[model samples]
Target: MRAAIAGSDAVRGTTSPNPPVGCVILDAEGNQVGLGATQPPGGSHAEVMALVDAGTKARGGTAVVTLEPCAHHGRTPPCTRALIAAGVKKVVFAVADPNPAAAGGRTVLTDAGVTVESGLLADEVELGPLRAWLHYARTGRPHVTWKYAATLDGRVAAADGTSRWISSEESRAQVHDLRRRIDAIVAGRGTILADDSALTARSADGTADGTSVDRQPLRVVVGTGDLPEGARVLDDAAETLHLRTREPSEVLAALGERGVVDVLLEGGPTLAGAFVQAGAVDRVLAYVAPTLLGDGPVALGASGVSTITGAHRFRVEGVTMCGPDVRISAVPDRN
Candidate 1:
């Protein structure tokens, strides 16, 4: 199951509207025979690839997968049918498919006399690769992770408004990697006017690798503010969306209509405050540098919280060192 989870990570960003699944095939003697991960949209599913690799070894073998095999047919036949025909005697999966259109694989396999078990390492799968897609399934909107880099004292910039180099070079590289895994990256008009960022996911030196980025996430700018014609985001680096609205919910709704499942929110403090006040932010990624700015703009603006009890709160998910900085990941904890 752990190997299957790792395989799912291989194609994380490429598959949209489709969960990245992984599969492992074990012969009756309990020796692993095959392994496979999901491909892009309209491609063969993980189960099919593993079964093909297993060949004759698949007969009477146990198939372990990260997600429950899909039951209904769309671009391809149902994965349940493929597993049955492969003579697989047993199937084990981590998480149940939540998408209503492609669920119920467990019942289908059981009806076909194939033993099926689920919920093996379900928490790990939910909190890891499946986090974004599952959120989309549960809510009719994209999962948003607000990302920001600031100094140790919660300052985003210096008193002179020179905000460059708050975090280390390693932290910036990590942000680029995060951008590559999501469907979109959004910034407010203030950020666009201040930085004019292109928001393209690339290597540290700002050069495209030519292969990994077959498709780049949509670069989005929010608010009714006009941008200069020479803005880097206006170039042909990737597709850009200029949403003339200040409402975070409206922005997410528009992206959802375009089949966006995950979004990296890179907006400024004002925009972040709006999202936080409206309860639209699902996760937060904060990079804290070792330096401190005595007087500067804060990492977040007012979020309608005037008292301690009403303050925005998040549960810490992870904390790690990124070169000379610290990266903290947290999720909304309303309770």
Candidate 2:
């Protein structure tokens, strides 16, 4: 199941705007029979592709999938029907679908007398194919990741405004890796004005790699403010939107309405403060340089969540050292 589930990560960057999905099939003897993962956009689903490969053998077997087999019709016919036709005796799933049209697919199966189970590999499934979709289901919004590269002391740039690379090549490559999975990347006026970034998800080769080509994420700059004369961000503004505003939640809501399933925030401290304070930052990825800048800057500044009760608190999730840079990740505490 873990090997089958891990396959979903390959399709995450391509599946976004669409949901991430994965599938596995078992033989009557309960041995692994066939497996398929969603390919880039316009590719066949894991179940459909697996069934295609499994042929007549899929009958009388169990299908283990990361998500509830989608019931409502879309690019393909309902998965529940497909599984039934394939004679999959049982279905095991990690998470329930929240789409109103497809929400009851599991019930449909169980009612048909097929052995159905939910939440079997829920955590692993979430970390795999259903990750982004599960995030949307839980919060009515996609999982948001805020990333920043700060100086030795954590300053993004000196108050004097000399902003070049703070972290090493390894750390920068890691940032590009994060860019691949997100539906879009956001920044405030200050970030755009100071650093004109070409926020596209480029490969380590510095060339465009568009597996799910049309999945090009909207490059969002949040402000109607004029940009520098030769600002790179403005050059690509046609693929983005600039909304002058102070309300972070409103901006997030607007983006959500536009089919932005997930967002990556590449910013300095101010916007991070706003997002974290609003209870909007689901995760923080910070890359800390080993050297010290004395009083330069830090990854996080003063948070803006109201009162101690409203403060943004996180439980450390991971710590990784890449060269001289130490990467730390934190998740919002449910409490």
Q: How many steric clashes between backbone atoms does each model show?
A: 0, 4
lDDT of each: 0.89, 0.75
Q: How would you encode candidate 2's per-residue C-alpha lDDT over 1-335 as one tens digit per residue?
A: 67557766666766655576777788899877788777655666777877776778899998888778877777767788888988889998877887786778888798777899889878877755666667777677767789887765767766666655678778877777777667788888777876677677765555566663334567887766766677776664237777677467887888878777778988657777778877788788888877655565555556765478766678888899977898998888886
TM-score of each: 0.95, 0.86
Q: Which pairs of residues collide in candidate 2?
A: 154-297, 154-298, 155-297, 155-298
Compute the lDDT for candidate 1.
Answer: 0.89
Candidate No. with top TM-score:
1
lDDT for each residue of candidate 1 in 186-264, tens digit (9 for 90 to 100):
9998888887778899876567766765667899999997878889898988889999998988999999998888899
